[model samples]
Target: MHNSKNSYIHTSAKIYGSTTIGENCTVMENVILGYPQQDILLQVTSQGKQIEDFEFHGCDIGSGSFIRAGTTIFSNVRTGSRFRTGHNAMIREKTVFGDDVLVGTNVIIDGNVSIGNNVSIQGNVYIPTHVTIEDNVFIGPCAVLANDKYPVRGEYHPIGPVIRKGASIGANSTLVPGIEIGEGAMVAAGALVTKDVPAWKLALGCPAKITDLPERLQSLNKI
Candidate 1:
């Protein structure tokens, strides 16, 4: 199959069957789109899961998107228009990314994730499965978001963290699964987020604790 004039796929990139790229998109060299899943880790987990929800096939990319070099986007992923990813990124299957999203380089995004519009995830971030990131959010570089709380034989289905709209996560912070980050909240750099952060608050320290919003942001949106 041939790509339209509105779209450009580099010669070195490999696009598998059942995937569709929209108009005005540029996929750079060595960028792999719509590759099948291995799911080796899920196989080792409890076997009798309802397989339909986790189907892995291919993907659909929206118009005016830009995929950088060496990015591997797994099958069954879908993204809206104006989506951009940095080089050497890993976006797994069963993920949905909204419009105008920016994913930085060396980011690892697992399956079953949902990212809202106008979100920016910086470089070297790790996001596990079952996570929901709301709109207008900013995740700093090197932030690690986990999913599995108790890894005892994977007895239960894992649920990742929920980042509310307009939230900001600082660099090198670690987020435990199943917690909620309130809207407009800000987490400090290198903090370990264990609990829920209230709306418009600031969180800091190893086990993140809420503080008054910074003077700069507080005046903008007082709560």
Candidate 2:
């Protein structure tokens, strides 16, 4: 564990491997940083071996981070400065977060995801692998972003949703795999988006229909 100056890590927090906690960070109790990935852990357990013997790629959390209690961050994850997470959030391996990112309580970020600056993901959101969220994106509560169209059936090439800059994914919305939400687009609450939403447009209802965004809502997000 390589902690920078002025960082406050609770004694109960478990930091492993070559993890680096940046300056002025606060890691709360019960937080687990640099936990081995699933595949690595499985392999070690199958052979009745200890995971501590392996040298996994540890995580790097940037300056001014606030990692709340019960959060488990897998190895190989990196986050920019001012990153914050609510209680019980889980960030998997190979996920990258940009500056000023906020992940709410119970949020599950599957590995291989890329999130840009100023992104806010609300509580109970599920972000699958291969997802890309651009700058200033807001993912509301209970939102589900899929990556696999056919799960355990045929040829599996997971391509998650791509949320462009300034896009807002509404609460309880479900985005199907591989769809691109264009820049400045707004998806209405409870909408089930099955295709691409054009830039600055509004998508509404189940199997959402695209429509023009209101004049008052046309402005880019200031997140």
Candidate 3:
């Protein structure tokens, strides 16, 4: 394989067959690509079957995407252009990320997820499977996105959450599943989001409240 200037693939890095990396991309040290896994499990799986091993389909790094040092991207993850990440970020399989996305350090993103463009995901965040994040959204550090509203032993069906467009979730927050956060809404730090958040409102506290709207959206009151 050929190497380009301004693009660094560390000697310690291991890349497997048929991988495509765009121009001006930096693949740092100790990065591993194309781990093995069971087919179509990342997409969806039925019960009574155990996930045996970790597998990778392939990874596509878009142009100008800077993959920081020690970051690991498991197989079948598709990422768009101008993507950047902090050190030691771990992204699991079957995930799709759009252009100009910024992911902070020590972030953990699992499979069956989709993230839109211009999103900012802070450090130490845990994003579980089957979640969808729309465009221009902000997810703060240590935010926990929960998929199960109620857990029962006999019935073990997991459903992931969704963070809508232009929504800003403050640091250390928790979003319960089966709820939609409306466009341009804001959730304050440390709040537990248990319900659907209305558009252009600010929610805070243990169960979250509509304190006020930000100035940008406040203009609607004038009309």
Candidate 4:
């Protein structure tokens, strides 16, 4: 039962000896941390660096954020207070999640991304790098946002699409890179976004096309 001045860790949790935990946070039981292992399959990276920085390994977890059991927060990640993620979620490095963000189970958040406050990302979502998810955005389950249209073999840059504020990406949808999903836009389930989506427009299909409507998209129209 080791003790720290400003952090809380449960005795049942088996974190690696080299892992560094931050202050004002709770480390739950049965949490397995495999750090400093190069060939491990669950290699999560952040900010173009390996998740290895001991100090500031994770960002400021706000006063009220409750991270569920089995969640892995990679290195170089800086998030605002009240950041909550579901069980077994993987938040990759250098990602900034704003206050009151909720990421559901089995979600894979890639590196160098920015998630705004009050956003809810449903289960099993994949967010690649250079993607900006603005405030009040709802990303449903299995939503995959791709950043590279023509991904090269050994080149890495700020690639991928932009998801604007108040946008709702449906379940099982794919967002192609370099495109901008306008503010208040709605992408239907299973749609493949290949081009720019205008603001307040509803798009759906294999090669997603815009749908014209009188009233702007206020909320997610469930499929």
Candidate 5:
């Protein structure tokens, strides 16, 4: 771990190889950052589309970030300024987060995801890979996001839900794969989203019916 002089790394934290921590970052106790994933898909000769192999390459954390205790971030995870995390958060490799992101307690973010600036993810959220969360997005507590259509022994095609800018997901909501939560959309609590939600609308019910809700979008309504 190559930390800047201004960064504060706790004694109990375990940081893996070649991680570059920027200025004035705070790494709390028992935080594990930059560790690599053991399993990886090497190559596919027929398609000739070569994805880069996963390794313990490195990670770059921007300035003024704060990582709480027991937060474990895997290798190749990149983040911009003011990245904050709560306790026991697990972030995997190839995940990119923009500036002013807040990851709440016990949030598990899987690999190959892109999160934009000013995103707030609340506690106990499970975010799988191939997801895109745009700026000013708010994910409430216990929300579950998936990527694979049929995860168990499926054909390895995974497409996560896309949360657009200013979108808000309420608590205990489950978003299915390959769906889009449009800009300024609000998802209700305990909703199951199986389809795309339009911009500046509200989604509710099992299949998540959408409707124009100007009040929620304007005031940023609570779940």
Candidate 6:
């Protein structure tokens, strides 16, 4: 564990192998950083192995991060400066987050995801693997982003959604796999997006209908 200058890690926080916490960061109580992936941990435990027996590719959290209580950040995850998470957020392995990212409470970010700068993921949002969220995107509460098009039927190729820069996904929205939400697009509340939405367009309703964005809603996000 490499804790940089002015970092305050709570006594109850579990920081494992090779993890680095940057300057002026606060790791709150009950937070687990640099935890091994589920399969690896299960294998190790099943074999009665100890912590030092296996090498872990640890996580790197940049300066000014505030990881709230009950958060679990798996190994091989990297986050840029000023990353903040609300309580009970779960960020899995192989995920990368850009600067000024905010993950709200109860958010679950699965592994192998990419997130750009100034992104806001609200509470109860589920982000699956292989998703890419560009800069200044806003994912409202209860939004779910899937990666599996044909779930549990046969050979599965998981391809999640690509949300472009400044896009806003409204509350309770569900994005189907392999779709691209173009730059500055807006997805209205409770929308079930089944296909790609062009740049600066608006997607509304279940099986979302694409339409021209309203003039008032056309401005790029000020996130």
List CA RMSD, all candidates: 5.6, 1.3, 5.8, 5.7, 5.6, 1.3
List TM-score per model, in order: 0.87, 0.96, 0.84, 0.77, 0.88, 0.96
Measured with C-alpha atoms, the lDDT of residue 200 in candidate 1 is: 87
Candidate 1 lDDT over residue span 59-96, tens digit each:
78888999999999887899999999999999998999
Question: Model 1, which residues run further than 4 Å from truth?
Answer: 39-57, 152-154, 218-223
Quick one: RMSD of model 4?
5.7
Error of 4 at 22 (Å): 8.3
Model 2 lDDT per residue over 1-223, tens place:
7899999999999887789999999999999999989887887788887766766677999999999999999999999999999999999999999999999999999999999999999999999999999999999999999998988988989999999999999999999999999999999999999999999999999999999999899877888
What range of 10 consecutive residues in model 2 has the weakest lDDT sum? 49-58
List the global CA lDDT of all models. 0.86, 0.95, 0.77, 0.72, 0.86, 0.95
**Which pairs of residues clash in candidate 4, taking residues 3 or more apart in a chain or in different chains?**
46-93, 62-81, 147-160
Clashes of each: 2, 0, 5, 3, 0, 0
Model 4 has a clash total of 3
What residue runs in model 4 are displaced by over 4 Å at the alpha carbon? 1-8, 14-26, 32-58, 152-158, 214-216, 219-223
lDDT of 1 at 126: 97
In the predicted model 3, the residue pairs found to clash are 35-55, 35-56, 36-54, 36-55, 37-55
Relative to the true structure, candidate 1 reaches a TM of 0.87
Tell how far residue 137 is off in model 3, in angstroms: 0.6
* Model 3 stretches astray by more than 4 angstroms: 1-6, 38-56, 151-154, 216-223
Please give, for residues 18-47, the per-residue lDDT of candidate 5 as tens digits. Answer: 788999999999998877554422222333
Model 6 per-residue lDDT tens digits across residues 1-223:
8999999999999887789999999999999999998877887788898765766777999999999999999999999999999999999999999999999999999999999999999999999999999999999999999999889987999999999999999999999999999999999999999999999999999889999998888877888
Q: Give the Å shift of residue 33 in candidate 6.
A: 0.1
What residue pairs clash in candidate 5, if any at all?
A: none
Model 2 lDDT on a 0 to 1 scale? 0.95
lDDT of 3 by residue, 45-97 (tens): 44433333322246777889888888887668778988888998888888899
| Deviation of model 1 at 137, angstroms | 0.5
Deviation in Å, model 4, residue 18 alpha carbon? 11
